[model samples]
Target: MDAPVRFDTKVALVVRADLAVWQKLNVAAFLATGIAAAAPDALGEAYVDGAGRRYGRMLGQPMLIFTADRDQLRAVRDAALERGLTLVPYVAAMFTTGHDAANRAAFQAEDPDTPDLVGLALRGPKKAVDKTVKGLALHG
Candidate 1:
């Protein structure tokens, strides 16, 4: 077998720890899309099965998911920004939003200084990402 490939960059998703199971799942899925949009290069090529059926492409690199409390989530967001990493955030208001426009409006209504973040994702160099998520535990 060949040696495992190593990625220089890391992808991480962090969700507020107190959310319900369904909310966590929703947040994770939304956060992942943001990472995909920001890092198109990370997407692997589409796949075809034996019968020539095509499948959607996925991220070539692994993404770590973590759980954090409100304060911890804010800190992680701050750290990601401080390190100049690509960041995407999902605010609590987004849960009530029915569409993209409403979501945008909800996000916009948030204070620029401190959004009421329910979850966030980051894409950056491995070390920086590590530091940003330090002390967070993997989602169970």
Candidate 2:
């Protein structure tokens, strides 16, 4: 079997039946960055080359993944979860509330679980990813 061409992680492919969930939701994508300057030894050169791209690719969108070790995942998740409270809402508030506005509808319907799922969605299909970068820049 091949290592699947996952949008962000292995979990996403299973959760998404078609690509519609990803298309409809505004996701905040996050990847697991290995230890940073705070722990230079752990976040050494190897970690930088591999994990940095993974981390940077998903950070601005609406999802999170544990691509690295447990420690790195915990640190990233803790910081991100804290940041997410403010960050997620701010991103959601960007959409205009109108009948034709699917984005707004999704945003309005967000619960904690959905928002996290949305974050994953944002990290999806190449086009959605392009939009996520643009959206984050617009709001950030």
Candidate 3:
């Protein structure tokens, strides 16, 4: 059988560190979902060890975290778009009260005004990802 394909790239989830703990967690989860949807191969597979314990490895894929404010987030979004890079953006409605309500809000909230970007997940060539996120500091 042929081996499973693996991506030789880097994944980064840049988020606003100033958000509340819950918001941060929500952003991270949404961002990861974006990466998984875009690059499933990068996630690798689940395997069992000799002791019969199962382990889930992130495939050793590099996932760098960075912090940015509202303006910085917008800049990153623009940069990603300009570079033709895939961007998974988390919007304001994602922090809404309920799942159904959030989805409704998000659908209604989509407009030309460009909803605020709370978080972003970008994946591509290592050099490309690095360049796109240049000048951004690592999440503290």
Candidate 4:
């Protein structure tokens, strides 16, 4: 069999630092979910206990967290895109605003105005990710 698939690089989940505590948690969870959805293999398999309890954990790759505001977030997004890095963006309206309203606005709106990005998860070569997120401070 081929060697087990491994994520040999670092992953990052960056969030807006100015958000409320609840919003920070929400953004973190959503950002991680986006990464998990996009790169399931980066996560390890689930575990089972003798009692048939199940637990799951992320494996191989370790994630680094960072904090940034709206302008910084936009800059990172643009830089990542320009560098051809893979990014999963979490929008503020989707989590802070009501879901139905956010969805309707997103789908029904005709204008191309950009939504507010609350968080982002990026996975790729270590150098590329680092370059894309350079100068960003860690989340407090």
**Model 2 TM-score (2 dp):** 0.21
Per residue, candidate 3 scores C-alpha lDDT tens digits across 3-69 of 8745567788899868998888788887887788787776667888999999875634757789988
Q: Pick the candidate with the highest lDDT.
A: 1
Question: What is candidate 1's TM-score against the reference?
Answer: 0.97
Residue 97 lDDT in model 3? 44
- Poorest 10 consecutive residues by lDDT, candidate 1: 70-79
Instruction: Show where candidate 2 strays beyond 4 Å.
Output: 1-78, 84-100, 113-140
Better of 1 and 3 by lDDT: 1
- Please give the distance, in angstroms, between residue 80's alpha carbon in candidate 4 and its true position after superposition: 1.1
Global lDDT scores for all candidate models = 0.95, 0.29, 0.78, 0.76
Cα lDDT tens digits, model 1, 1-140, are 99999999999999999999999999999999999999999999999999999999999999999999988988998889899999999999999989989999999999987899999999999999999999999999
Per-candidate TM vs. native?
A: 0.97, 0.21, 0.81, 0.78
Better candidate by lDDT, 2 or 4: 4
For lDDT, candidate 1 versus 4, the one ahead is 1
Clashing residue pairs in all predictions, respectively, total 0, 14, 0, 0
lDDT of 4 by residue, 58-90 (tens): 644667889998888888888777877778777
